[model samples]
Target: MLLPFHRQQLLRITLVPLTLLLASVAIAQSAPSVIGTRAVLTTWSDPIEALGTLSADESVTLSATVTEIVADINFRDGEQVEEGQLLIRLEDGEEQAQLRASQALREERRNASNRASQLQERNLAARADVEDSQSRLRQADADIQAIEAQLANYQIKAPFSGRVGFRNISIGALVTPGMELVTLDKLDVMQLDFSVPEMYLGRLTPGLTLNTTTAAYFDEVFSGEIATLGTRIDPITRSVSVRAELDNADGRLRPGMLMEVTIQQRVRDTIVIPEAAIEPSGDRHFVMLIKQSDETTRLAQQEVEIGERRQGDVEIVEGLAAGDLVVFHGLQLARDGLAVRLIGIADDETDIRALLEADR
Candidate 1:
């Protein structure tokens, strides 16, 4: 009976403290509220971005001009070669012998022509005979030149300075004209080729500056200038092909590198607001507008069309106007025409990027 009396006293004390805690919570919840706003009057600007790829401005596959067996390869695969450097050699064989034979025939004809000239000077040869000997000498000279040119064709030289690709031909391998010997790419300067949609076609032009970045070189940005624009747009994609040239004097940029490119279009002044200020539902978009009150606040809903979005700021294309108070926070608890206290305008301009960094 004494223990029961002590427990009852403890319960009475706990009930009084708990009752006071619940009453305070209810009063505090009814006092004020936290809300966020975009304060729509902020200035806005929009920029367009695109993607592209890096490639060598000049690339080609080198091939031999005649049928022959490979005798030697002077350059190794993937080696940088200078203009006129010897790349490959083919067996000269019969061509060399032919050149020598033609040379001997030319000498014999020259000797015969010299004798004919001396006879003509002495009045012992007919004019037609001298003329025939002169003609034979000329014909022999032509044959020797032709044979020499054919012999020279056996040796292949690099046409331009560039990096050589993998070697496709081995010693003693028979190759015909037009067979790929190797690929030569001029990487000192590279070209970026990409397409832009027709919507931006009017803004595309030669000499436009662009900044390009690649996954391979994440730390660096490659700068390029527009070099060419396709005269015609593709009917299927409704896009135009654009070529930009970049200087790769350091040889960091390479061919076949996937890249993302950004080009800035025209600038326009408009009202900028936070993306959170707008409510998106199926095909409609709207924002909660805060109205002023002597001692309380009011809310109104307005439909809006959004424009270019960047860095968390979206352009207000229509509906919302400058100086319009846009609700950014406490939207879930807000309703159309709800009466609220101004308390004060919340600092809705929190850098969303900073919040992202904190999360990371």
Candidate 2:
């Protein structure tokens, strides 16, 4: 048999190993598995969204200036017209006859003036006679010009190149001054009008890019740049009006269509993290950051100031740096100073919505 001291030494050695084994088992059970992602420097923007209305770059309601019977309609409904193209012809037979008569009179007076000048040069007529003849010829020419000016009023023409809307009146209809005939719209480009809260007035400026969407074309995104801004702000609404211009080569956007406008006012390169990584409590936000110590990963609770939250990402304005790893999944299992096992580093191309759904 062994001595009692030897037996005691053997028991102590076996118990020490058992104690270490128990300690390791406890650590493994306490540590939580989490998915983490590194904070990256990315361009982040503060987007301003508002309702807007689309308008033609140039629009006008064509109208008649005088009451007269429409003799002929030169253009079809919804026709594209060029500038100065004839649109309507009113009854001008009387005016044409008068113009012809005046022209004939002018020609006759010019012949008489020439004869009188020749007689004066041959010493057969007085200077006063020649002067009188020349005056009559000038008066006839003036009458012809006056008749032509009146004739021009009876015809209607396009003022600019644009697509014409449907005509309200047909041929032989009497149109009065200021009567609506059609609407002409320059649709090669579009104007978007919107109002933003006066709080963003300082950020308003020309050349700011805007993205717009409409209910009619839900899949299409139209882009434009700020063309103008209203000079005054509405005190009651505390808003300012803004206008942007978009190219509509496809003629998809129409006037008076409601559009959803989005303006990216400020963009900056900043530390960005997944929105799931942030834990909000009361008025403060905290993130569980993964810190490595003694060859083991642990959670470090960090308070961060967030600037903007956009789509699945949050801008970290303070208390975070690029390349820092943060826990994006299993937040409930994470505690400050507790050990953690990194199950995986989230793929940068992974859809945030998918991750959220998985978490759910």
Candidate 3:
């Protein structure tokens, strides 16, 4: 070991250089890392909000046309079915017997008609007898056709392709004419119906795009377009009926689901910045802008004339041009002429800490 005096001298020499190195690092990082934002020109619109209800594009309540005992149920609850697919078969024992008997009689009559016609062709049978046999055959055909039509009434089939509702009746249950059995809905596309006040009637038109959200899928935004508008406003509510259609090929949205709707209209182009960047000073609004000169960048306070404010953005009408950088986050460093380092763009998606670490 060296003497204490010599050690003190060496230690002082080493610590002095070490302190100098640390001081240099601190000077390099003197400028705070801040997430910067650039003025962006974007389309602006006036948003209209309304509550709506969703419905299947095609829906119907399945029921029977005639009173009969249920013979068979071909579908389960919530089953997908095709058009003309048989769903229920009522007891048709009597109709089946009638059909069989009519078919046999028609065959016999046809044979007799053929023999009579053959005899007439050779001039061996009377004209009246041949005509009588031919008429009998025609009558038999009509009788069979009538029985077949009656039998069709005993069967219930789907009118369109869709999912079937809950089973309302079981096998052997008695159903009457027009009795409610089940429901069928085509869910590939959904229809949303809402009411807008007559005050905005002049702006209502077909093909206007709208966004809708439901409580069931809060994070999901479904887009649709105006399909139609009611001809007359409701006298009581002073509101007009509006219908919009949305594609629900995934079947997440169901009939009778309540949704919140927003429609955008009267689009205009404007420059916008995050609302957090604005600083209020009595009647004036100011923003901290990043000014870059060669390799040095500093903050400058600018008074900007603002237009409409929507959501989290404020429209700048004056004192800011497109591509001008502004400090969106770290507003605590609001001192004018303060130096700041540009770490990253503070877009809506990026996290502030992540930006600082990436730049560091």
Candidate 4:
């Protein structure tokens, strides 16, 4: 029974000393731990943004020229064709028969003309007979040419080298004149068209470089140069249209794809700081800028005018200079004028999460 009482007293006496020792240790570490970053100077540009659309380098819709029954389809859907390649053949049996007849008449007239020329040279035929034979031969040649020209109306050929679209007509289907057959597009280069306000006309011109982004290829940036400028501004909207050409060697960009365009403008050197350092109060913004006085480092509430927020960084318009340090993390425990211990400097290459876990 005496040993138990002694043990209790011993614990009570050691409790006070242990509490004091812990208090002293915690007080020594009471200075808030924070992660800081230095403000940097970098180039910034104000870019002009606008919406645009992409089109093929050359696009056309093939159509029928004469009302006739479809005889043959030479090309399939989505097939690449060469210039002057036959795409379709309409039924032309009557024209073909006429062509053959014209050829035979031409051959007979040519033989007669040759025979008349020989007889005239030997003085056995009159000059009038030779002239008549030559006239008939020329007339036959004209008839053949006229028939061949008419036969071309029944055939459809590709006007240029490109990829063909869907086949609209089948064999034996009667097609009328001016009826749409299929579409063709040359996709080696793409054309982009956008509009800009008239006020920006002075800054725009041919050969200016621009970049475009689309939802289909979100991470990819397509670049091009201005090809044309609008001759007149739209009186109603006060905007002018602009056209650009983009190289589509991979054939990824198709016709009618909507794009967002960006053009670079004025560039300036500005001070930038970590975005996480900003503290919002009501409608204003502030940062806990690290200050050094004598041997102690303290924090001060510095008001800043921010311009643009970029990837993990922001442009500081005022109240900060290059090489200035600011507390980026541990802001919840920060207080103005309080002494702080710099645990780490947040580096651009280092991940923020790894830094936080290490401090914990």
Candidate 5:
């Protein structure tokens, strides 16, 4: 059953070529083609966004100082009023009558004091009578002053220049002391209250500028500067409170309006790579570099440290350079030091073109 010597030699020789062919086919099928790209270097400004709210810097609710019926409402709802302008008048009829009576009594006391002085000069009146008349005159003057002050309180004046809110009291309504008449808010300037993490405390200062936009007015962007920093940090949130003042001269911004604030952080030059170029394995991150020859290409693995990420790009803090070629997609098919064949990209436009041509 054994083959002849020549036949056996021919079989062994053919076996070698067959084995080589199978090996080449297996290697080609096992490895895959991966599309890649180069990491480009660029500088970018870093910005952080936060949520905030708008509020009036100056606001107050005017109220009655004395208990009485509202006699007159001088200002309409939502009326712009100036400081010291009369806004409301309570029933001052009683106070007015009391003031008039005090004034008459003060006149009579003055006359009595004068008559007493003349009698004393003529030695027709004792010193005690003159002293009593002087005391009565002083008492009458004090009573008149007290009545005037009380009557002035019946007329409520605007505390500051602002727009009045809806009237809380109507004419002829019995009003008690400390009863609210209407609300007022100075809208020429507004305060935006927001918070930032304690880590940003150093970056935020009294004069730092920021940009803000509201949901109600999405297209409009308002500018503001830091006005005040909280002396104490919130223990629960570990965040510091900050406020910025915005000039709303046109009265476009309303109190209680929600707004979004953006703060630009300090910029630093660093190497950046597209997010697609980075491959993560456990705690390690890496990329693949491609080098080509005349007939084949090769891939090399690289490790890098990544920093802050914005949009679709990640910053490279270390382990990368400006000219590093990185695999963009199909990284799962890549292997260390594997030969490759680029299916596309002409030699004229490739970085590996010169290297490949030289090798040929």
Candidate 6:
């Protein structure tokens, strides 16, 4: 047996180790629980966004075709016009008089030809005389047709149905050929022109749906579909031009309006988890994975490769699989190989997205 002093020292050392072990057990039992969620296989898409401009489906600037004095202005400024609608009439007095005179002469020549044919049938006129009268009749008809064509040139008609802009010419104004009269635009369907990086050329195709927003209508979102793609990529910017068509039946969208566009390609299936589960350390990412033992659940430190992040979920590109449980809350309280209590599972019914949105 040892002396009293040696026995006291041995007892002290033995109690210290036993007390420490009991304290560790108490801490383990009282460890805070965390919410976890299983990594799920879901569809995700990569969205492409760019700035674009809105244009009319069709546009044209109406102009005068001949140098003449404007005699009549039928349409008001900024009015809707129908195709073939007479818009302006120039000074056609001289042309009208010439047409009328030619028409009267044509009628006279036709009567002469008829009379000559009758006389020839009766052998009362020479064949040469009949032929000469018929030739003069044909010439008179051609002159009438030429004069009528010239008269039509004095009138300006709408070539298509569209909204007309402000007119530049007024009645009595002398206008020359190619002089601006007004602008016409078909606004039933609008075109959105934008550019994307050349790398996405393979994915660009007709009929892809897209959404757009404009400053003029901030709360409204317009929908469209890809209508055309440029033949060649722009060498200087390394981008490809794309055009999308949007229905504007309400006439809310106008030409030359600036807009923001977003195009989504296709959905891809991948493993996803709540972003709260990630424990970033330096350049690497970690997660507290929940592992079930024979009678208890424990935490295991897992390193993962991160991919695209959207909403409140992050994609696990590697080092994780579907159905794997991961701790999303109380990550600070977790330790490697330590036992833990699971309070809840973050799943479809958990409203995790609402929580994330509230946090934001």
State which candidate has the highest TM-score.
Answer: 2
Which lDDT tens digits does candidate 5 get at residues 40-116? 67775567578888889799888877788888888888889999999888888877999999999999999999999
Model 6, C-alpha of 13: deviation from truth (Å): 20
Off by over 4 Å in 6: 1-43, 268-271, 274-276, 279-286, 290-298, 302-306, 310-313, 317-325, 328-334, 339-360
Q: Write the per-residue lDDT of candidate 1 for residues 1-360, one digit (tens) a residue.
A: 456888999999999999998986765456334354554555443344677777886788988899999999999888999989988999998888888888899899999999999999999999889999999999999998888888778988888899999999899999999999999888999988888888988787899888888888899988888899989899999989999899998887888888898875555578888787778989888888887766456788888988877887778888977777867756776678776543334454566445434433
Worst 10 residues of 1 by lDDT: 31-40
Candidate 2: pairs in clash: none
lDDT tens per residue, model 3, 182-216 = 99999999999999999988997899999999999
TM-score of each predicted structure versus truth? 0.68, 0.87, 0.70, 0.73, 0.69, 0.77
Residue clash pairs of candidate 5: none
Cα deviation at 255, candidate 5, in Å, is 1.9
Tell me model 3's lDDT, rounded to 2 decimals: 0.91
In candidate 2, what residue range of length 10 has the lowest lDDT sum? 351-360
Q: How well does model 2 score by local distance difference test?
A: 0.90
Evaluated against the true structure, the overall lDDT of model 6 is 0.89
Clash list (residue pairs), candidate 3: none
lDDT of 2 by residue, 1-360 (tens): 666998989999999999998998889767777889899998878888999998999999988777889998888877889999988888989999999999999999999999999999999999999999999999998999898889888988888898999989988898899999888999999999999999998997999998999989899888999999999999999999999999999887899999999998777899999898999999999999999777689999999998888788889999899999999988998999889877667866867566555643
Stronger candidate by TM-score (3 vs 5): 3
Give the C-alpha miss distance for residue 4 in model 6, angstroms.
Answer: 18
lDDT of each: 0.80, 0.90, 0.91, 0.90, 0.82, 0.89
Ranking by TM-score: 2, 6, 4, 3, 5, 1
Which stretches in model 1 have alpha-carbon errors above 4 Å?
A: 1-53, 267-273, 278-307, 316-328, 331-360
Sequence-dependent TM-score of model 1: 0.68
Range of the 10 consecutive residues with the lowest summed lDDT in candidate 4:
23-32
Candidate 2 global Cα RMSD: 3.2
**Top candidate (lDDT):** 3
Per-residue CA lDDT of model 4 for 255-298, tens digit only, reads 99999999876668999887889998987899998887775678
